[model samples]
Target: MSEKNREGKRTARERMAAEREKHKAAEKRRRALIVGASVVCVLALAAVIGVIAANAGKDDSSDSEGPAVAPSGAQGEDSLVIPVGKAGAASTLVVWEDFRCPACKSFEDTYRSTIHELTDAGRLRVEYRLATIIDGNLGGTGSRSAANAAACAQDAGKFVDYHDVLYQNQPAETDDAFSENAKLFELAAKVEGLDTPAFRSCVEDGTHNSWVAKSNDAFRSGGFTGTPTVLLDGKNIYQDQSMTPEKLKQQVQEAAKG
Candidate 1:
């Protein structure tokens, strides 16, 4: 072969090699950019998730934060009962309730008027015993916290009003909004003169948390079915499907006559 032809062919081969190297370098840079972008996206997603988790936890009330103390005028075993109405009433209605329980709210909505009328007439006395069954079952602190807040209201002689207000504004069982102290105080504002500094302090400190816990323990030990366990003179009247508010009133009146 001619020398010029050989030189030309060698130059052409070198140029092709250089072009291939350039393409390889470009591909490596492209891969590096893709990897870097993916890492950045992952980190950003993690940060967003962290923020959401933190916000959720901020409002999640924890029932294990402090010792339980019974509220003023708390009666019955271990001072767990918050009594509404005169002590000497003819019929005693015992209620086991969870503020976060929807059934309890349903009961309240249905019989609140009848119960209040009877209580105000000094015919029936309601012994409200709080439970945290919802909290135990659903994995949250709203029940306990709300119970503690009710106990605080009991201390201020505003339990019945505050209790009704709570039921009126009870959140969904899964929402856990009552775990926030602010929400509790917000509901307290509904009860006339209930949002006192002492009340707020009591709720904030979970002053009755231990008492609430003990009440919940007692409820579990009692072998009750669920919240709104309304007993009229040792009978689970709430379980009586034929019974109504009128029937309850009649029964109470009959007992008063006896």
Candidate 2:
């Protein structure tokens, strides 16, 4: 063969090799794009699933079948407010509270007797609005559970007694102790005839849980951030620094007169 012909054959071979290298590089890039697309799709799907689960959880806490209907004898829009005074009393004292709130316990301990005295005399009616702000803020079910139990007590015609007992034995804010059914029944036993099987069943079943949720929703919509919010004839007296038990009683009497 001629030397030039041999060199031409070598050059052809080199050209073919370079083409094969280019094809391999293009194939690798295609595979890399495919892998990256798969990864992105998987991440998007996971994020969608995560969002769905989170929304479902929120619905479980907030939504319910047939909406939350307030129980019988309940006052206020959501029926969370249990009236504690005479049917035709002159003034309405509304109290928004959470069973697990320490400040609420203090308010109860200080003014429970005064409230009852006023109510018994038909001087004013006290409306109790239950709330579960602690559960949302602190990550637990104690407030909801206690509120359910209280509503159950309302059904059994022992709301005031149960309310007093709950505040009297309120657990620390961080303890979440009221999340237990047994503890609630035990406290119910303190109230005369409140620890019956029916009461226990109601508490265990959480029959009023939805109602409690409704109450919390009402509290949120009422635009109050904390518990023990006391209102006199729609006025927020609890916000007043000088408001004491005596002052509250005086205000009620004065309202009664006018």
Candidate 3:
């Protein structure tokens, strides 16, 4: 072959090699993309499974036996001052709550809407057990004041209303604005049929001291290390941010079936 022809053949071979390299690089990029996508999908699936497992653990932990109860008083009493559900229902759930607990507030909201339906149907009853874990956190005044005010409102036959208002007006967990005794009184006055003077006097004179102490003692005996511990038919129902009205309703329905 002539020299030029030979050179042309060599050039053609080089071009073919360059094209192969390009294809190889493209294949490598495609493989990387596929691997990255697979990793993301696996990660997403793992996250979903983790959330489900965490929720299941929470449900199991909450279903453990609740705190111990004393022989008498608020914890052991058959009746509660703050009526939670309807007047007469076979299955009653008693909630021991701290006014300053955000989780308690969430539980209260869920119960208020859903329990109202159950109560209206006469399928469920609810009772509030005022727990005061916030006392020490709130400079030893907020929790006691809120509990006392609730008791005082009970004396005035407006415990439920007062309880609702307290939860609505609850301050941030990091802040202790609910510590003001005066604010407690203010909330009491807002309850219809509540005589402001009588309620204030009761709060000031510690007329509800026994009730407050009893509630706190019950909370302690119940092995509640935190606020918003719930008791469903004497069984503890653990609550957290993930607790929803649907889950509670399902639990209640299951218990009713038994």
Error of 3 at 140 (Å): 2.6
Candidate 1 lands at a TM-score of 0.75
Model 3 CA deviation exceeding 4 Å by range: 1-83, 86-88, 239-243, 250-258
Per-residue lDDT of model 1, residues 1-258, tens digit only: 999999999999999999999999999999999999999999999999999986663323334345657899989978888888989998999999999999999999999999999999999999999998887778789998899999999999999999999999988879899989999989999999999999999999888887887788788789998988999999999899999999999999999999
Reference-based lDDT, each prediction? 0.90, 0.85, 0.69
Worst 10 residues of 1 by lDDT: 57-66
* Residue range 71-135, candidate 3, lDDT tens digits: 12232363333564555566887777878889888877767777777766767877777766766
Query: C-alpha displacement of 118 in model 3, angstroms?
Result: 2.2
Report how far off residue 240 is in candidate 3 (Å). 8.3
Candidate 2: tens digits of C-alpha lDDT, residues 1-258: 999999999999999999999999999999999999999999999999999987763533342445564655897664667888797888988899988899999988888888888999999898898888888878788888898888888888999999999999999999898999988988998999989888888888778788888888778887895888998899988788898889988988887798
Candidate with best lDDT: 1
Per-prediction TM-score, please? 0.75, 0.85, 0.61
Stronger candidate by TM-score (1 vs 3): 1
